[model samples]
Target: MKKFIGLMVIGLTALMVLSGCGDQKEQETSSGTKETLTVMASGVKNGTQGVFLEQFKQMVEKEYPELTVETTLLPDDQYLTALKSKLSTGQAPDLFLVQPKKASANSVEELAKAGYLEDLSDLENWDKIKDQGKNDMSFEGKPYALSSSISVLGTWYNKDLFKQHKIDLPTNWQAFLAACETLKQAGVTPIVMGDKDSFMIQFGMYQVAANQVYPSNPQFDDQLYTGETKLTDDVWVKTVTMYNELYKKGYVTDKSLGLGQPQAQQSFVDQEAAMIFDGDFSLTAIENDNFDLGFMAMPANEEGETYLSAATGAGYAISKKSQHKETLKAVFNKMTDGQSEMFTNWLATATSFTTYAEGDDLNPVFEEIVPAFEAGRSFYWSNQAWPSGTETEMQAKFSEMIGAGKLKPIDVTEAMQKKFEELTK
Candidate 1:
């Protein structure tokens, strides 16, 4: 019952925010002063970023007597498309977006270097938030973008299903198989997936791959990218082998191929699958489903080592073309008020931790998994860390290998090396 109500709220919030709420809705609001700001946000419905916009109205706009703001929401998939036109023309949004990815990230760094992002250095609270928000959210020892929140991801599961079916959660390769077999015997799917969105499959691959690639340290894929190490390294092969085995064993839900997020998510909500390996953002869906979800790392290797599921949030960038630097700064300062509040609320409720020091109470579930991630010192999300097309190529090749019956651990390692080679050359 709780899950049903939660899902209803989740569905409505998503629907209202996306559908007719006008892609660009400017409240007929006013500040007694002369400054009125037009804020452009990336994607109104997906990503917690939208929640910032919606909450901004109630929290910032209503409270500030001297500042007025409007919002223009764009879809995430098309954010770049719209951003190109807007940024090229000087009439771009006062604030836009940036999330670090593998390929085009250098360009993002370039943008920040070139002053395409508003510098909040002069803000009053800048010093207060810097200790936690600096490295992960912003760059160059400055708060170019405030992270509001950061997170760790891994295997999200339903504890009730696991207990009822008497299947222990797997912590290693062999144990994982045993658990899956037990679930299968009980007519419960071991995992739920939504491969209709390619990123879902990619994230699964990345989560498993991270363990093999970065079993122990801050280096994660940073070294691999810089050639400090090679993917043909044994660990990479084993990572691919581990995940492919799960796929072969029928542990991952078959509906994953046919379903997009919503439809596929039903498998978990309906309790047909015991687990799904996704990120913190999926918490909204989980709350909506009202399931008593639990989480753990992707089962580790024989040595009790595993990788991490982690990625930074999309950073908000100033329009390269905006003429209102001073005005933008003022508006952005106000946005921070909105950003910070939303950041804490969203993260605390969503099982994520913010890099921001002034964090909200941790989600109850995060308490269980956070320590494991930190203790392991495991890290990396390949697509987020690598270049853009690298993910497309590598993930596609991974799926093809699995489908083709040739995706061994070593094959995965070799394939990563080849893909990385192609991308670099």
Candidate 2:
């Protein structure tokens, strides 16, 4: 009887020890007394996204003394592959950057569809996001990411050069061409394009489409999805023709097809060119202390009818496989509070307009087009609504048009429509 009791006690003690170990494992998986929340994104360590992540880590660590935030930033070329690989293998970080809509492989819509992103609609501060931003970050009526900034696509011109040439900012297609002629006659390259970097083609083309396509038919992309309309429609042909006209007129820099984006940006900053069409993201690359820079909506329409190409900036998304989901949610909630130090620091790092109401002060370079954005005379980036590869198709066909001079605008649109059908199907 004494031996039996002693054996029972030993067994009970072992059971208690095993139970304690299980509890410790559970706590470690969740937000334990000491846990790490990992973050990954694509950008330079000191770039806007890097600053945003550093601020986020500081805020999270300060708020939750027991938690540490670890961040890793990769260049754009490697990020998507690494993220997709990590996600497919169930090794994704707690949080990562995701583009709005189906803009990229790591876009909110794509990742949410693949079950890699958490459904963030239930977040406490979800409603604080701007309606347009909400739409961009949502897939099938459910939010998957948080976008704090709004990116605008337009023309960045040398203010000092414009002042020296006594040329006024153009407000319409006709006036814009006249201004280009003026610059050309003055022996200045009116516009510079890095067509060698095929994606740069969209910077100008999408701005033109914003005015020529969406203003009249806001549901154009939806119509395409439902077979109600096609990219080969006359509107797209017109948009392409207008964009081609710039190349045909020799208004753009000579042999632009041979130059990459960095070269084109360098030319603009060196005062060899008067203007370059780009998005707000390029401000850091194009801005020069030697001259004041000015940005404006591409005057692709008639007077008083130009449309701005703008959309929600890419932002953080929580991984569905993250063990620290609750902690990540708390961090995101704090960020959207508007009164938090995190929110203020985020607004300060914004290179473009912010989606939050507290972000009222516009960047001086973008001041010229603030009215258009405020007046709702703007459209989201066209490719954001389409599948990822559609823009690549457009770029390739358009490059054929510009380089080989073999494909017409109609031909380019036909190819784009075909590629769009294949991708969506």
Candidate 3:
């Protein structure tokens, strides 16, 4: 009897083990093999790109139940360093952020040249991208990244302050200067710039360059690359001089070199300043202020000519070494198809103008600058076409000119030319 009882117990134990193994196999078949896609970028957790990343992960997982997405976001400097290290070490993420053209260390052209970016030419939504955006993310005539939005850089001004001081919106360089003078005379800060951040310099200077440099010579940057034109040329000198005049005349806030971009933005939000130069991406920071706001292209041109400094914003590029190429490609196709729920969510979350046809209704604040786009009077941000370090050189020299008054406009241009030569070589 004891022997029989022991045999029964053994049989039940074996049956239970087999049943557990069968259930495990069934679960694996039902759910499929799990895979993970990795993405990396430079942005804050709640920033536009961050929000987009979260949405992308959710949508992708919903569509492919067996896939998981992992994201790592760092500050700009740290991201650049980490991305370069990872790419070199053969451990880069499946998809990573890259600047348009040669605009940064991790730009599409540079990575494509280094044979790190995957060719995305055959993406399903390839034809839907605007020509300019396509060009911005292309290298050697092949698309390497997916650019989704157009970033417009312009003046974000407090409408209440402008009205309180009885100042009309300026449509030309002379009028702009006059308005500044009027605002200064009224004891209002005409503009607030955070020169301490260095990059803030580009916000105002690029607008001036769009008018003074590109209108007559749209090929200036191309010529620069080919050694056909130089930064020390008269046009750049004039561009620098025109932008410097604002600082020289004390129209910008005092001690601007000590303030950071956030502080300057806060000043504008608090209505302590009439204007701040920024891109459409900054809307989230300034949009919620109690007073009304307006955005317009800085009219740095003469009376009849108008130009806007705009460009394709940063976007994602796929690593050539990624094992999940097909999955990443599918994500891009679905997100930018111009018809998917993901596409609609992306348009709403994007702070910049949509590159696709579906999202054309811009915020009321950007309405004033629509004419420039319609008239084809918009130029890509000057630095977008230049080598990566060119803007850094410009920022440093321009800050010297503003803070110490030690560098003249000509000196600034000469320094830029030297840096450009060194970088190109």
RMSD of each: 7.0, 12.2, 13.0
TM-scores of all candidate predictions against the true structure: 0.78, 0.87, 0.89
Question: How should the candidates be ordered by lDDT, best one leading?
Answer: 3, 2, 1
In the range 1-425, model 3's lDDT, one tens digit per residue, is 00000000001111111111112221234547776778787776676556656765765555455557788877777888999999999999988888888887888888999999999988888877788878988999999987667888899988887888788888899999999998999889999988788788899899998999988899999999888899999999999999999999999987899998789889888888889998887887888647988998999998677799888877778899887776566656765767756566545544557667544768878898888887889998887788878888999999889888888999999889999999989
How does model 3 fare in lDDT? 0.78
- At residue 203, candidate 2 shows an lDDT of 90
Q: After superposition, how far is residue 283 of candidate 2 from its true place, in Å?
A: 2.0
In model 3, the runs with Cα more than 4 Å from the true position are 1-34, 54-65
Candidate 1 scores a C-alpha RMSD against the true structure in Å of: 7.0
Task: Return the top candidate by TM-score.
Answer: 3
User: Clashing pairs in model 1?
Assistant: 3-290, 6-288, 7-288, 98-315, 102-386, 102-387, 103-387, 103-388, 211-307, 237-409
